[model samples]
Target: MGLRSALFAAQYDAAMRHAEHEELSSRRAALLSGLRGIVYDVGAGTGANLPYLPPSCRVTAVEPDPNMRKRLLARVGPANAVRVVDASAEALPANDASVDAVVFTLVLCSVPDQAAALAEAKRVLKPDGKLLFLEHVRDAGAHAAFQDMLRPVWSFAAQGCQLNRNTVAAISAAGFTVDERENFTVGPAWLPVNPMVRGRATPGG
Candidate 1:
């Protein structure tokens, strides 16, 4: 892995472990509950969402960062059927319309091209498949301005994570019709990246 990837992997779990709280756990379980067949989890950092997946689902985790993959492998429980692939969101290693569902959690911001990644997610999904996502997004007013101001520095330190990405809008632009959505703020009010969106989207209108 490259320097940025190494750095991100080193600090990722420590920085994000708090996200495994009860509320987020409930949300994750709910998101993965309906999914079945083959599922590709993009940016599966440390395999945080693995436990929440339904037992009926088979998972393929795509993670480009090697260090993160190491931890992810460690987290894969004995019973859960999981395969790991070295891949990025912009380019997934799966056949067209082959996957039953695509899962993304706190991953859209760090991708170099959110739209391209979303397009790839669409490409790998079955016609009736869903894309489930949980992401931090740009808020309005002063919070948004704060995100803009700190994004340059933050991205450099946080492995290309943009603090101000309007991910929901980007998802829509990538040809996925958002069938369900929930927007809310997490963490402290003072944090610019507190605003988050979680939901499921389907390919085409």
Candidate 2:
């Protein structure tokens, strides 16, 4: 990884530690509860979603940043059914139609090409497979304006994480049919990236 990627990975866990509170934990568990069979966890930073996953699922964690991968390896328990792949979201290592489900939690915002990443996710998923996502998106009104204004500086500081990504639209455009969705506000109201969406999408019609 480059210097900026290295620095982000090094401090990633610390930067996000406070956000790993009870509320988010509960939400993650709920988001992951239905997943089963072979799963690919894109952007599995520090393996935050590992514990929340069902034991029936075998997870392939795709993370490109070396520093984040180090912490991710440390977080994986000996008994956990997770394999780490050093790959970016736009180029997953999995084979076509191989995985039962693909998981994306706070990932789409940071990828250089959101459409390509989602396309890759769709490619690796079986026709009957599902996509599980928990993402913060561009909100409406004043908060949206704020996110637009702060995006340049925020993306620089937060390692390419855009504060104003319309992730749901991108997912739909990638050909997944959204089946269930829940939208809510998270963190303090003042935060630009506070509006979040958690949902499940299935491949094909």
Candidate 3:
């Protein structure tokens, strides 16, 4: 693995400490509560959602980055029903209609193909399975323009995390019916990744 990747993984939690402690952690807890059965935590970076998930349910934490996977492994304990797997978002390891739920927390922005990843989520999910998602979307008006301007540089530095992705629209375009959603911002107002959305979706008929 390259030094940059290793460095990013090593310092991820530390870099996110302020945001998590101040805003995102409580949202994550509320969003992940009561989830049951076989759930997939897509792009499970350092297992951030591990603590919030229901222990009664099995969790398949999918992370493609080896460096991130190493840290994620350290977070899993005997008490937590979590399994760390080496896999990307576009290509999952589960069988079709096998997973009870799929989770995406601040991950869609970095996936090579957001549509394909969401498609895979739909493919692996049972007919009634739900998709729980929390993502920072494109901002409004002038902020969106600024995000576009910052996209190239920010994405390069942040390991391909796009500065402005319309994740909620992408989720709907993937044929999932958004059942519930709430829009809010996190971190400082100057941060580019503001105007986030957390929601639940079901496979559309």
Top TM-score model = 3
**Comparing 1 and 3 by TM-score, which wins?**
3
Q: List the lowest-lDDT window of 10 residues for candidate 2.
A: 16-25
- lDDT ranking from best candidate downward: 3, 2, 1
TM-score of each candidate structure, all chains considered together: 0.93, 0.94, 0.96
- Residue 1 of model 1, lDDT score: 29
The pairs that clash in candidate 1 are none
Give the per-residue lDDT of model 3 (tens digit) for 68-157.
Answer: 999898899665668888999999999999999999999999999999999999999999999999998998899999999999998888
- lDDT of every predicted structure (CA atoms): 0.87, 0.88, 0.91
Cα distance off (Å), candidate 3, residue 86: 0.2
lDDT string for model 1 (1-205, tens) is 2877777787877776676573477778888886789999999988878988877888899998788898898888665589988999999999999999999998999988898999999999999999999988998899899999999999888878899999999999999999999877667766766788789999998
Model 1 regions more than 4 Å off: 1-4, 77-79
Measured on C-alpha atoms, candidate 3 has an lDDT of 0.91
**Looking at candidate 3, what is the lDDT of residue 179?**
95
Model 3 lDDT, residue 128, Cα? 97
Model 2 pairs whose backbones collide: none
